[model samples]
Target: MTGTALDAATTELLAGSLRELLASVSAGGELGPALDALGWAEVLADDPATATTLLFTEHGRALVSSRALDDVLLAELDPALPPAAGSRALLYPHPAEGADPAPLDGPLWGVLLGPLHGVDEVVVPATAEGRTVLVTVAATDLAAAGGPATGFDLGSTWHTVAGPRPPGSGPPAPEAWTRAVAAGRRALAAEMIGVCESALTLATAHTTDRVQYGRPIASFQAVRHRLAEAYVAVTAARAVLDAAWTAAGGADGGGWAAAAAKLQAGRAQAQVMRHAVQVCGAMGLSQESELHRHVTRAAALDALLGGHMALAESAGAALLAGADVHPVVEL
Candidate 1:
């Protein structure tokens, strides 16, 4: 959902509170109850744009993971989803084989890019008889079919399970799936914005404090230019994402927003990671530094959903198919 454009004062106020909450969240604090206490449900219902951007961006900035992506996807694509009850996750098609579908009476192969603390079932998107469909799989079945799959995110889970779909959910609803994927892309772009921002922040701090020739390396022109380039990339990507949300309901069923957001963010992620790693130098790999953690998360996000190559191809194909995606940044 495109966020309701709240006044700047209100947005700032919400950002301040969200910043505090996410700080605690990254330090290993409970989130669900606190979110409910903060009227998260109301905010999500009333101002989803604010909720999506502020919450997910803060999540990425803190290097924390949650079921927020699941929330965004279900909101747009939940016609066939389960009733809000116990724990559940909507697993995306595995990036390696994004279009693969679960064979009828068989299992689903997908990637679940989050924690598996108390999840009960995973809803996987698959194709049946040339129609995109959702298939429900028990978490226990995921465990039985195969243990965790290899991935950059240690907390992430792999889905290869089988289960019964709630009656009516098995029917093909390609439109809903399309909308869900679009929502997923936007949510991911927001997260990447945070990721790139954090990486830049860390690099900026590191570079400023780093000494060379009895002077702060950040004072050097070359270092300054490198960081400047990184900053521009982050800003441009952020602007693109903002513009996309403004046209959330675009031609081609709004697929252009999704594609454009993902493409720009993917480019920014690559640029930010490269610049951060270069600036941080050997310290980037050290356990004492936080840069590595952000780097790993960036890499994982880059792979998840789609990397640059895949995203570019998909975007080109979308444009070729007559999808309009010219998002004009107003400010």
Candidate 2:
């Protein structure tokens, strides 16, 4: 096969693997172990960037990998989660006491909040300055230290693994942190594409099965038009994501592409999920039905790290301030 064909085949294989991994996780399998058994951990360790792209090919896979990335990059935690190893962890630039805390999913090993700079206590409205430090504390330690409470209702249990900052650890480089955050937004865009596609599939299936006036609902012109529109939106979003992924390899325009991709993907996911529910009627909201999972996951992702509108505004402001602009499709 030609190089392009080989790349296409590899992407297809990775998508299939991610789909199976999602199904397994839905069937009560542990995500970390499943990823390891599938050799994804080795892939991540070997080629972190490619592994990120593969993981983002599916919503469940992306969700697991994104959470794991926090530990792998920020805290230097073990990915295998061995008996001696701690559970998956989350890291955020800690907000001030009484200020709203950032939302998180899954158990946290501890919370690292700061620009410490040799301070003994966390100050309100922390900012990065000279000799910045990150103060770490377990979830329980928050209560003992009188720190502000932080939690998220992502339908998972988050436990405290340890307490206060590790010795000899300092703040991460500003560029590294910025790259990690950008990569996370791109991963979210990929997950949005997966969710939108899944919803479109469910909608298509339901319309084909449901009969109205002696004909399948999908046979109707209006139904077909709506579905066609959704398909277009999904296609556009996917193209944008692919472009962004490619652009990310370049040093100059990657952030701009990622932001644009995220904005478009978020909008596509919202529209697709809404249309899917409408097509499925009351059945879509039923707890026993699989459609709800896609909708719920889309909703959760939409709220993460600022939604589409926020991303658009940020991108717009950056562009206005002399940031480079690039076309989504180059002739």
Candidate 3:
């Protein structure tokens, strides 16, 4: 086989792995052990001396261990609450002399977090084996500790759950999770491609079946143009995603390529979903119809990694500054 063939094969394998890993994350399975076995864990794990770049909110804060550097004693607790009448309000509740923890349990976590993030909400269960905890870390406090008040390191917190040693035994190397995430993103982007195509197909089918004054609606110039645009957008998005996936297979420059893929895919997915909704008109928005479900899933997945515009801007800036814009994997 040639070099290009080898690269394509590697990408296919990585994409498959990514799809499976995403299914696992959604199914609530841990990947730490699997990653540790890959021999790349040390490279992926957090370095206390050097901070890592991450996609967290501007006012992010972390809850560190009070007992140990890795313990869950000090958690980053954000009390997500509903929007108050006539204004936005943040309920930063301090523990009363005898505050009960029961009120903290249940759907309230999700309820409070929903409005803050402006995305589909979820409440990670608080089970013994391992669960997400809420910690209240003040910006001032964090600043006083000699660091910016912006990003956080969740990997640091993972140490507490598994103790000084990392979790898992003989398994894939640590870098596996990074590769897995990249691959997973690519697969999801591919699924979005499938979704856009299906939506266009549905619209075309409807136009063909529904008659206007004297002929099929598909004969209308406006309908034809709309479908043509949808086709272009979906196809372009798919191409970017495929190229990004191929780039992600190599160890050299996968990060930038993955970013580009994510950015392009997200915008394309959103545009395609909106176009689908417009083409279907009232029927598309119906709760009973499967079209809306596909649209919703596409919109949701777009933000699964990060904002498309931001990624695009970053990619553009890097390019303008003469940074390497080529795909990392040599194919």
Best by TM-score: 1
The estimated TM-scores of all candidates read 0.87, 0.70, 0.48
Q: What is the C-alpha lDDT profile of model 2 across 1-331, one tens digit per residue?
A: 0122225576678778877777656322245667778887555655554556557657443333224334333422222112221232334433121112222221223333211222233211112353223333333324343332223424322222233332233332334434444666677777777778777888899999999899999998888888898999888887887777666655542778877787888888788877888888888878677777777667656555557877778889988998766654565
Q: List the residue pairs that clash in candidate 2.
A: 107-158, 107-159, 116-133
Q: For residues 124-205, write the lDDT of model 3, one tens digit per residue.
A: 2221222222223222222221221112221111110101211112222224323433543454455556556666777788
Off by over 4 Å in 2: 1-6, 26-30, 41-50, 61-66, 69-88, 92-126, 129-169, 250-253, 326-331
Which has the better lDDT: candidate 1, or candidate 3?
A: 1
* Per-residue error (Å), model 1, residue 267: 0.8
Each prediction's RMSD to truth? 3.4, 7.8, 16.5
lDDT of each: 0.71, 0.56, 0.41
- At residue 18, what lDDT does model 3 achieve? 38
